[model samples]
Target: MAGPIVSRVSRVSGANGSSAAPIFVDVDTGVDDAMALAYLLASDDARIVGIASTAGNVPVDQVCANNLGLLALCGADVPVSRGSDRPLAAPLRTAEDTHGPEGLGYARLPSRDGTLTDYDAATAWVKAARDHPGELIGLVTGPLTNLALAMRIEPALPRLLRRLVVMGGAFDYRGNTTPVAEWNISVDPESGSEVFTVWSAAWGLDRPTHLPIVLGLNLTENIAMTPTILSRLAAAAGSATTPMSVLDDRGSRSAASNPLIRVLEDAMRFYFEFHFDQGEGYLAHLHDPLAAAVALDPDLVRYEQATIDVELTGTLTRGMTVADWRGHWGRQPNAHIGVGVDPEVFFDRFIARVGPYAATLG
Candidate 1:
């Protein structure tokens, strides 16, 4: 069942009508992360100012390589930077089983001469915020480590950006990583806690009308990608590929003519298999891409304001996200928790934006 598609400025302009929405991307380069980055690169309304590679789906080193390589593949000249290889307080753990080795599933990127910035991810994040103060839109589809670190050095970080969108947590929903915790937050609960804490504090100080919008598992799991959707995307890109099917072999690869479509098909095949093996279905939840979309267009999803907190002490619920509604906690609402979205509308946007972009590439 689909949800309502709220209407808002899908593409925002500068106050002086001079520039597109300046966005800063922080990602773990998961398969979905790749999809999200591609979506942003394709959006003419989105101006990607910088990218911060974080450690989640894979190590930060591989994340940076993936970011740089993806930018090169798309022929987009975007600056990529590296963040912490490990979590702020926990030992680093990766999701190679879910996203495959190197984070992009079975898809291989072409050799690229693109390089990372000399500064670290934390510095990159702070610098981007400082450079585009009160205008930068921060999108994090990975762990909160880099953002939390940046917030520490620059306390005004929460206010520095016009808006922030996060793709993590599970507001009383089934967790992808554990029985009660989401993968990104479970990877670094302390950092997740830090982000909410600092964001709430700064937001309280400034009292900005827009709160941080967070898309958690409760909502994201509904936006799933199936084989049929992939076929439509290929058709839109004018690529002929071996159609994906449940009857296909477990490790089948894509044969799309277009390079971008081929890579996405290959990557999504693994993701589909991962979910199917986990008893979900022959579909993959497009968590990150939805976050990327919501980052540019908040109207894609209906959000409810709430005070959200991360648990760090429970042995079994250390990374669990707890949302307080009805003023139970006596604190102001700190985040806008996404509660509804029309997957069809989102898929339509994805196909229309990415398919043509893919068609333009080799």
Candidate 2:
């Protein structure tokens, strides 16, 4: 592929000025996934340790291509890996409508060399947990198929990681792809069920923080994507695209600007168009990015530890998250339920963080 398009946006140094970014991401290369990846790669704190591609937003092959394309756009040097070709038990499905035919909207994609590391998505998960042991953060922004497969192969999958942050399941909110089923879980309920049961088991670490799954539900759905946020993102990208930008305190504006702004603009535009075409009242939601944000800064949301289950048998409730909010069932708290988020604070930080990096996109 040709070199990435350059920009002049200021890149956000690592969140705490730490040298190493410690996140491991698994994606299906959805536009939303690409945005979350952009945030991670652009940030100085959240380094890209590796990438594992799965079949969700697109076929396994296309997902790999999309991953490379986005990585190239961000000028990321992280290693890439190909994950599971099929779901755990059910027939595989893809979100062609939401993610487009390429899983990344209409953006031109990079050619694949079939050279990605051949790690099973689940095996990669197991190994990530083992390598980082009690300190690794595993962020899942796609269907739970790869994760389910990993647990099946290792059985102790949940115990392998420090955290398993997911952007799936709906509770106390309506679904996006179906009346009751969220797109990710509904795409593969069997895998979803397997994940719930495996993670629910208290066989590994003594601390409850060891394997708490962050449910999306009401947490991210209604969070609007405002015009102000869009404009800021676009401007950040525009500044990057322009020439003669000076290096600032954040980083080298000329060096990191192009990648940052282009990424932010690509993400914001795709998000804006999707919602606008659907007449979603001229705003979009940061569904996947919220998951990433929560991982980077949990203060963005107010969470409660609870026993959550994915309902698979109900005709109108399949893929729904049944959160034990009140402890009425007396079940052990298996995961963390994000019941509420501070919208204003989240939006402020999100824009502030993304805006500077976007300046590089131009």
Candidate 3:
């Protein structure tokens, strides 16, 4: 029972002569989620307003701690709020195997000195959206529970925001969590379904109004973090001439002087091992980071209109994202699905921005 679709193009830049692009991110704070936060923090064009932590890769409390730790590492004091402890309609299930025990792989971040905000995630999300109105970009890299709760509190939440970008689902690619389901959506299918349905209604799917952009496995899988890219980042981090070196106030030119870069490198070692074991190459898919990039610049990836729905009940297909690519359902196109991405372009921007932040850690 959502309202009419609010048709408008996403504007990444500020008006005339304003500041950077205002962004509010929701995350489960896994390794990839850490990469996404680092990317946003390092981007001169993005001004992170707040972060809502939800349960997915880890428990809600752990996710909040991880987010706070990441923010502390980047020297960012953005408001962080704890979100839903469990899914709307399912028992909490975590992905410890994929993200490690603490959800950060081998990377261990220091405890944040700053305390979390008084406002819970749902309130924080609604308030940020209300304050920014059409200026805030919502980027979600976890389960849809927090968003669903916010939408429930404010039914007109979709129309009140500028745009929504979700990093979940699998349109035409194999799932990473299950044979037919993506981790985020599969973690909480009911919440995911609620979000998709309400969001689709908010932006007239049938008539073609504003549509939420979905960066699923089909597109994100194309961007991988290979050893070659890691080597380049390490080189950049160690160079005194590079911006990354500026993060080391101690004037240490060595990459080891940067705690952030070291932590990332350590985390990636575990991630690389995981991927190698799966025979998926010696690279980890940059899933959440790619979604974050698309949020900041939609043109980075090619999109196609599609009607997307979440499967709620099927013995083997529960939580599967059912994207109607063939028009069999004849449903309205709820999502602008990412079908292609320029890996070179994405990595160049990612390294330029995120590499520095990672070098700043410690």
Candidate 4:
């Protein structure tokens, strides 16, 4: 490891000279999840304390490999933990179609064996929460199996964390995984439902808990990444390379300089190809990255409080998220469901941070 990304990104202190905020992330290492991790690595305000690899985009072991390789590639020293390989009530489903074979699109990470911690993922979350108490911000860009299981082990988890940001659900928008389900939630509805039910109960506890900011497809799909954005990203990184186009050969690799930039570009190219095949133009919806940004700064998106719950009994609507926006449920709002966002603003921040960060690695 030449240099650590955490050490390279200057920490932005608070008015009183406090250090950067501590963040604990759980992910499936989807292409967008990789982008999300990169965003965190670039942010001066974020200090990733730990990472958990969950099964979703790929198998849990594959996700672990992706995470280890990415961290090793960036010279990051954060601890990595392995999580559940299947859902609570259903068999695991992988999204190879969306994120490619390795869950990183066409890009393959530099594998790092024995990178996983001896302690499992649920232990990692509990340790982080107990260690940081009210200072740890949790982010889940994959299925909620790990976090939910953690809650079962330590029921006071909701009250211990400062906040949480989940990238799941579809709200009123159409689902990408099914007619009524989003990918993450659809992957593990039992865990997702348990998380919401338990988190909502925390509102009335002795130590009131903050509702998680859940960024569903409703708000995330709005932040699309097209070839134009990629071109701007490359220029921002000072990588003088051929810009990608729709006419480009499918599964083509990136021509960026050696290391992180090339891997990221290749990964995004696969994402672009997938979206194009789905008739979504040559653009990718960066759902996980948007959630990552929101974790660092909550004001990035406009959110509405909702008593959220996942449908588990309905055969057709199972895994569907039902957000009670009008307080019909009379239950405490479990999540701050995102409803609005300015894509240009997010892109501006993303390009500004990620581009310069990649250039440093290059």
Q: Number of clashing residue pairs in every model?
A: 0, 22, 2, 0
Per-prediction TM-score? 0.95, 0.82, 0.90, 0.93
Better of 2 and 4 by TM-score: 4
Q: Write one digit per residue (lDDT tens) for candidate 1, span 217-244.
A: 9999999999999999999998989889
- TM-score, candidate 3, is 0.90
Residue-by-residue lDDT tens digits, candidate 2, 15-54? 3555554677888888778778867765765666777887
lDDT of 4: 0.87
Q: Please, what are the lDDT tens digits per residue for candidate 3 over residues 175-268?
A: 8888989999999999989998998777663335357888899889889997668767765666322322212232123234567776676666
lDDT for model 2 comes to 0.67
How big is the positional error of residue 12 in model 2, measured in Å on the Cα after superposition? 22
* Best lDDT among the predictions, by candidate number: 1
lDDT of predicted model 1: 0.89
Q: Which candidate is the best by TM-score?
A: 1
- The global Cα lDDT (0 to 1) of model 3 is 0.82
Off-target runs (Cα >4 Å) in candidate 2 are 1-21, 110-114, 203-205, 237-270, 358-362
Q: Show the lowest summed lDDT stretch of 10 residues, model 4.
A: 1-10
Per-candidate RMSD, Å: 3.3, 10.0, 5.8, 6.9
Query: What is the full ranking by lDDT, best candidate first?
Result: 1, 4, 3, 2
